[model samples]
Target: MFKKVLVANRGEIACRIMKSCQQLNVRTVAVYSTADKDAKFVKMADEAYCVGPAKAQESYLNREGILMAAVISHADAVHPGYGFLAEDALFARMCSQCGLTWLGPQADLISLMGDKAAARKFAASRGIAIIPGTFVLNDPDATERAALKIGFPLLIKASQGGGGKGIRIVTSPDDLNSQLKIAKQETSSAFGSTSIYLERVLKHARHIEVQIIGDQNGRILVLGDRDCTMQVRRQKIIEESPATFITDAQRRELIVTVHRLLDGVNYQGLGTVEFLFSDDRFYFLEMNTRLQVEHGVTETTTGLDIVMLQLQLASNESRLSRQIPSCDGVAIECRINLTAPTNNNQLSTFSFPEGIRVDTGYQSGDNVPSYYDALLVKVIVNGKNRLEAVTLMQKALANIKIDGVSTNLHDLQKILASSWYKKGVFAVETLDMRLEKHESFTG
Candidate 1:
């Protein structure tokens, strides 16, 4: 029942959040960087403010400027649409101190789950199966010892951030020290923390995650699951609901375990618990404290507005006791990313299939800014079965066209045509391998 809510992020997510706010009759305030002054989300908001310059550090992540905008706009709450300051515990606290409701989890829970290393340990302690990993690394010797203990083929990862950055894979000791140094520097630069950890790598695992929501009264609801195995450079490109690969028993176990973990902690709002599935076992990966980039697929399958649920949780009355909806169909989402050639871009003909749902940050003729993430749109499709969903997605992608900017539309079509993908045999590294093979053959 907020009169006005300010979205503290950019791109498709911001626009998506505004749609939900509009449906709920809540006025929206949009804070944008100079690079995004004329973006679609800004135009859609009831009030807009320029936070700062193009760089995220000075703009989207500017806590003071965002707080000032919220205060000046008289926003009753702030909904950080999934990145930048979404998981910043201190920023959440600052919003609370300024008498604005924070739309996600409480500050303490955010701080606890934000630390990757600590989260892994907490999951293990709570009886959630976790990949064999080490605590924070102190020195090269410590890294060497952890490597030997966990065996070769391990991952060196930043302990404070996600989004697939600050990660390095090493198969032997000779590469450990060099990779560790690089990871530390990258981690420090990206997350402002030098903490690192080690984990035994699952060579071929299906990346599965469960969608979970909790309320102030400690009720936890599992909104089904998604398979995010189609990734390039450790970033997910395609996400699908109902997983389609796991058995009924495995799905039941995953839901029960995730529910148990959330029940132990006083978790609130929307979150995702990721896992690596291999050899009929699931290993906890990490928890995302905010809404995921692929949440559209879940929404398609469940027919529920996750952002609306988050708002209801943040409301003072907390009247979110509605029963969870039954998931009916299979859903798929494709992320449309702007290639390097489209730095200064224009969309001449932006159109999608009639039956498909496309979430985008720009309209036709809008300049695609290079200041933020490369993702320009998400095309989500739903069907009665997986095969139908895949076919619908292929048809939808083929029909869609956005001129004056290069994208991965053709790449996605090729993937859908491949036998390996059709047989559901792809993994996290499948896209990179396929692209490499294609390049080598062409060369």
Candidate 2:
């Protein structure tokens, strides 16, 4: 096992990863930016290093600085807790070349799956159905031709990036060229790659994702699926395990299909197979080659520590049991962000009710930095059933208090009380509909 692991990220994920490391009796090294010098994660680490300035390019995303920190800290492995360079194939290669165990998938697999266009082809080749889409297009003529074939109401997405960046929705052909231009520019800026692909957008699609972990020996473990349909601007805000509406047969098929696809690629470590579900059909979106933001809920449902499994797999020291464990209960998670209500820099009081896991990187009196992601904490609850989980979440959210900083607590409370949300029939557009109608449910 790795004696020390360097977490090459920040915020809630960084802290979450460190906790797993602690459970495994592994020391943790944290890398921070100038803006996070006094962050809670830094203080929690056995060793902490300031990589660079507040800007992500100079700090959290600074590959060289992170590498140097690992070297200085003598960490045997590096766990990139999603985002930043977690899915960057080159960085994974660099870590392996430096004799450090690279958590998550290998470099080649990361490269193959990171390209949204190529991943679609790969998925289709493995018998996983993909959405009606076109491969990476370079020029306006090619894009126009593809758009004509795909019809209006299509999404132009960046081939090399995720996290809802570098994507544009064009409702009609008259807006195609302009939207394509903007997507390319944003893609270039965000991922440093201008590759873009187009996919037919389904109205009222629910974002469903399957959590998968594999080993170097080709063993794949399906940790179950999550319904991340609740979103604002394509960013998931609420997620739950064992997707609510899908039938048992459909759930089994989804898991089996994803397992086959991952095995075909000889994928290693943690990954997520994301899909858009509508009309009782699953359309492959893309695979994320690292720990997901909502992994906490899955962990709660499965009773597994994903970060620990990543370490063991990367070390090639342990193999997962062949028997798949049954999911015990329903789990729900809400992302508490610094945005939405307000951005008060200071966090006066931060507390949550019992029977919930609060994964956070902030503490009372800590100044929330605008230089990074707005995520303040992930509130996770587990229960005997969906309704039970939802009820527990309500109690947790209602009693929780985080003053001095603006958070999405109120919005989340409204969502929990919404009628559509309670029925388990809500789609991605449900929240938008509530907002448009200015409806708020107190129940």
> Clashes in model 2: which pairs?
342-406
lDDT of 2 by residue, 1-443 (tens): 88999999988889999998998899999999998999889999999999999999899888989999999999999999888899888899999889898887889888888888898989898888899988888877887998999998999999876667667889999999888888888988877889899999887889999988888776788888999999887789999997977899999889888876887667788989999898889988889989999998888988988888878877777888786657888999999987743444888898887768989988888888887778889999998999989988988999999898778899999888776687886787777666678766433
Off by over 4 Å in 2: 340-344, 436-443
Number of clashing residue pairs, candidate 1: 0
* Candidate 1 accuracy as TM-score: 0.96
* Per-residue lDDT value at 177 in model 2: 84
Tens digits of per-residue lDDT, candidate 1, 294-394, equal 99899999998888877877675456555556788899999989877556788887888798889998899898887778898999999999988988998
Give the true-structure RMSD of model 2: 1.8
What candidate 1 gets wrong by more than 4 Å, as runs, is 316-324, 341-343, 439-443
Query: Could you tell me which 10 consecutive residues in candidate 1 have the lowest summed lDDT?
Result: 434-443
Alpha carbon deviation, residue 12, candidate 1 (Å): 1.2
